[model samples]
Target: MRCLWDCWPMRLTIKSGIAALLLSTGLFGAASAAPAQVADMPPAGEGPRGTSQAVLGAERYDAIGYAVPYDGGANPGAISAAHPTLPIGSFAEVTAIDSGKTILVVIAEQGLATPDRIIALSPGALQLLGRPEAAALGVRVRRVNPLGADQQALRDGRPASARIDAPAVLLAALRKRLPAPPRSVSTAMPRPPRASNAAVNLGAGAGYPVPGRAAAPSVRPATSRQGTGFFVQVAALSNGQRASDLANSLAGSVMAGGGLYRVRLGPFPDQASADRARADAVQRGFGDARIIHE
Candidate 1:
């Protein structure tokens, strides 16, 4: 998911120091807000803006290198990418020639220098790319102006045809399956539900009455902290042979998750350690070993 910052300029002045500290610690600002009702949000594959056309090329560098860290969640909808030099938030299109599939992913974070690759695919994106197995798959990258009608559709919550070909059909199905949008809580005149006197006593007590006796203590919800480490994402595959070939090449360094075989280097405690692992992976022929948060 994208990090949605409050546009209030005054808040920046009030908390510049705090913001800097949070950034240094890898905790993103604005993520502290209660989680949004993302259920209504479209799936990651719901549009073409998320899809791009990339031209495949030979691995550019012999060794992989790490890029700077990104603070956003591992959400495919956000237009972020890991590039050798492109500023954060820059937009690009990636196309897989083998399968004729394309996706537009933004530079959300920095990426490895080796495999001398274009963009790293998000987990959702990797699935869309057909899951190639080679240590590195060919990809092409080009800058795109992110202000077209397609982009607008994404920003405005309209379904993009590139991602959701049958929006109406899908929406209809979802409406049938999901409950209506929840009503907001009213602050005034709150009233308790109608219940018997015994039931009301149970509600007022520390533990509610169960059929047998007291109810168990309520457990707090789990805290949702972001992953601390990073992994490389290989998106797009032409065919099973390509996927198998890539998988075999990086068999030692790769692990499968969410259906994609991710090539990772470290649970490094710091960026320096991660960088070293990335460099070593590139030297060992895993040219596109990018550091991604786990």
Candidate 2:
């Protein structure tokens, strides 16, 4: 069976003025701001190491506050970001304007110095907040206690405060700042069932196991390959022809036989080869090149 994959193009606009100020004034400088005293920190053993409270509000830096460069496809599971001052791995709360939902994300990458925004979230962060279309949004950087604990609390229905030092206060503040969820899009694709353990082990062993004859492998139904590499299309094209044209310009071989024109990297027999190709493409200016396996 064949599947049509759509890559979404992301347009990033950086606020250059803010980038200059952050570099020159050192907005994150410890000397400019008093070092957070132990008393001001969360209670001991409350949150994960390096966690702190954060707040989300509107503030203008340079021209654009956030930049979403299409540096390959963004993963929806990772909590990465680009920030001007907050160190990588720092956590923050991102709220959407359309949805009243809020998600905590971690800083993953360094943002462009051109845009003067406080922080730029990873593509995964935008998806979690249900605002993948939004170019900019309000964010609050609070001092979180434990880094990943609050995320777990949100997922498991436990109170974030219970795992951290400040529960009541932070929850109350977040409730007011959260954004509403985005409208759902209709697609023919159906979600796949969860994976099973026996099947998992067989794949993990790669058609070989212990020296002795293992139990006969189960005859599981064949599954569709999810391409060797994955990429999110960032451009908005009205038709496959336009997509094909763009793909050709990028020197990407087109796979348009299936109605969807896919700009692909290779007939790579394995994922590692595709990954290397993707890296090479990025260096050559096709920063959006992604791996999709046949």
Candidate 3:
């Protein structure tokens, strides 16, 4: 009877061992079927990192004054412009200082080809910024939304040099002191002055061309310089032929300047005279006509 009781204890011990073994096997299988606990957890450093967080923030430059009459091919109305260094087709937001208005524009062609200006916005973009027909304005520009690659490039890249800002009051004052540029003259030779009796003259019948009329009075150089007179700019074109054509069509003189060939009415003596010419230009379909100084 003692031996049977001992065997019963052994049998119980065997059963317990088997149950524990089966439980361990089931746990091992589950562990093998599923990923490790740490593997299931979020990636390392993910707790502090987020999609909104940037490894390096975007760079911003200080104020730059942009010039007007931007030219970007056939689509003059497009809210686009050109920059000297910014990648073409990239997007940027420009904020006007005085009006506090902002505009989104795409970099289109090459800029004004000058270091004096940063980005040149199209007329449409300028109008959207709430300042239409402004010759120049102080503005801040920065990349707003960019492509993934562009963002990466920008983050890794160095910021561009800030453009030199022109002082408003100083520039205005200097402009007031500037002298008007001389008008363009045709290549046609001026009529020779009539020879006086005291001057040596070729004998007549030498096929020499005689003066058609009285000699023109000589223009003496002014002792004191005059200020630059006002002018009305009708059009600014890049194509020399097109500009010449427009100038020929217009009644006034043409001036080539500001990166694009310009068609202007006159170097009128005063703003009042320029206003009258501008009115005439507006009547002839030049709606963007504006007064200009040399």
Candidate 4:
């Protein structure tokens, strides 16, 4: 019953309020919906943001090069070295590939210092490593973090900084490298199963010896820097004494490395002997026993 003109403003105000309410609700819904959708979808790429996928995908660095003798330039008696990859002020383990002798040396210099070589040690350092006259001694340099006290000693250029004693278990391995002995097959036993698809070749151009059986694909014999002959790997245990005990029982050898003690059987003179030993080990409840030809 209200007059149209008197009611027009009121009706317009109500409509405007309703519209404002709808607009606010729509904007709120839109903002909330976008975040929810984003939460459901994982970010793309090899990893999430800030991961810098390149670092995660990069290959591990394996340093293999030569160690050359260097006359002490400014510090003749200092046990120091010039390296290519190791940072200055850091310590490294330089091992002779042929002699298996290992020594710790400080990195006093760096840069393009060693062109093709991995490290250039001082004359004293080289002598300590027992490679004083070696021009291009094949070496593998391993990085190590020295103790704070040792770091101070190394900084002072003390000989003790370079002194290191090989573990008893690793003593034999640290000796001079030798060529592997000849492998002879025993005709007494039937041909054993191949452990791998890859063929094994004896050096001196020797071929497989099975009669009436097709020889396996010929592959080059494996070479070892420290010359570890064929052996059966029994187990890697935490206790070195336990490994020693096992080794004693089986006439095996205990090799300590990588924070574990390895119990191995037979650096047998030949492969046939190792195979027989491996078969025996498998029969003796070592389900994981396998010949380590490498």
TM-scores, one per candidate: 0.29, 0.29, 0.32, 0.35
Candidate 2 lDDT, 179-240, residue by residue in tens:
43212212221212222211111222121111111233332332232244444222222133
RMSD of each: 29.9, 24.0, 23.7, 23.8
Over 1-294, each residue of candidate 3 has an lDDT whose tens digit, in order, gives: 556545978889888888889788786367668875643222222221112122235453323454344533335567676565555445565656554455556655443443334566666666666665555555555555544544443233322212223245433433333233212212242322322211111111111011111222222232222236787877644344554456657755434322334556666888899899989988988776778766
**Each prediction's Cα lDDT score?**
0.38, 0.39, 0.48, 0.52
Query: How many angstroms is residue 175 displaced in model 4 relative to the true structure, after the best TM-score fit?
Result: 13
For model 4, how does the per-residue alpha-carbon lDDT over 76-141 read when each residue is reduced to its tens digit?
A: 477787655555566766656565566667776432233345566777777777766555566555
Off by over 4 Å in 3: 1-63, 113-115, 146-294
Best-to-worst ranking by TM-score: 4, 3, 2, 1
User: Where does the lowest 10-residue lDDT sum fall in candidate 4?
Assistant: 46-55
What lDDT does model 2 reach? 0.39
Q: CA lDDT of 293 in candidate 2? A: 40
Give the TM-score (vs. native) of candidate 2: 0.29
